[model samples]
Target: MANQTKADRAKIFMPFDAVKGFREALAEKERIIVPKTELSEERKEELDRRLRMIHTGDIITVVYFHDGEYVKLTGMV
Candidate 1:
């Protein structure tokens, strides 16, 4: 048997995830689907004004409800 230190021996028990889609495939098989959400009339009008106010070369962070959660994403206009 080869002489190995604690760090070297610890690596032997680490998980191997080299296969690209294996984890995603397993997650999809067990994922719970969430219904989509719609904005209210007042909320829609509020968002419209915010959109119009954003001019060229403006950066914005958009917050919306999706998949039973509030997701925030940033992008440049």
Candidate 2:
């Protein structure tokens, strides 16, 4: 221990997942599979109108579905 370098000491405390792949498997099991819903004609028209109103520099928040989940992201258009 007395002769160990700074880099060697840092390596001793490095983080690691004790249970490999266990967290991911648990998360996958907890996730509910949701079916995608079809949008009605009126709903589709409303979404189209809102999309057309967005400009290049506008800041917008959008909810989109990916991998069986709806994620909301806010950023500049």
Candidate 3:
């Protein structure tokens, strides 16, 4: 028999406010993964430096996953 390991899953409590503005609910909760890009070396360096300067609770814009679409949106700041 092959060895099998149990997978762990995290429960994400997406607040009601997160879905309030959307016309569709289930269509807005999809999986999204974005990789950091290196378009310009100078800009990338600046962003990295600024990221290190930010404090906890500071917000940033990221990709929002929908049922089949990914949208870029701004969150808390």
Candidate 4:
């Protein structure tokens, strides 16, 4: 029998009013995840299409904030 292992996770932080800068940072690392807005049906469809490509065991890094204060970053594999 084979043994199963859990994935890894991480968290980081960046400035809030630095959206463009954030993208530049990701680009430099050769990795990124741009969020898709769900403002309309068309946008939702686009997001769905993009998300469909994501799969398990794939690494995902999420950027956000805690208590709407400091910027919070996290990653899952």
Clashing pairs in 3: none
lDDT of 1 by residue, 1-77 (tens): 37888889999999889997999999777765666668899988999999889988999998877666566899998
Candidate 4: minimum summed lDDT over ten consecutive residues — where?
5-14
Ten residues in sequence with the least summed lDDT for candidate 3: 5-14
lDDT tens readout by residue for model 3, 1-77: 13433332222333445556574655445444455443598877987897787776778776645544567886665
Across 30-58, the per-residue lDDT of candidate 2 in tens digits comes to: 88878777899999999999999999999
Please give the lDDT score at residue 38 for candidate 4: 29
* lDDT (0 to 1) per candidate: 0.84, 0.91, 0.59, 0.55
Please tell me which predicted candidate would have the highest lDDT against the true structure.
2
Q: What are the clashing pairs of model 2?
A: none
The digit string of per-residue lDDT tens for model 4 on 42-74 reads: 866976786787787877654443433334465
lDDT of 4 at 58: 72
Worst 10 residues of 1 by lDDT: 28-37
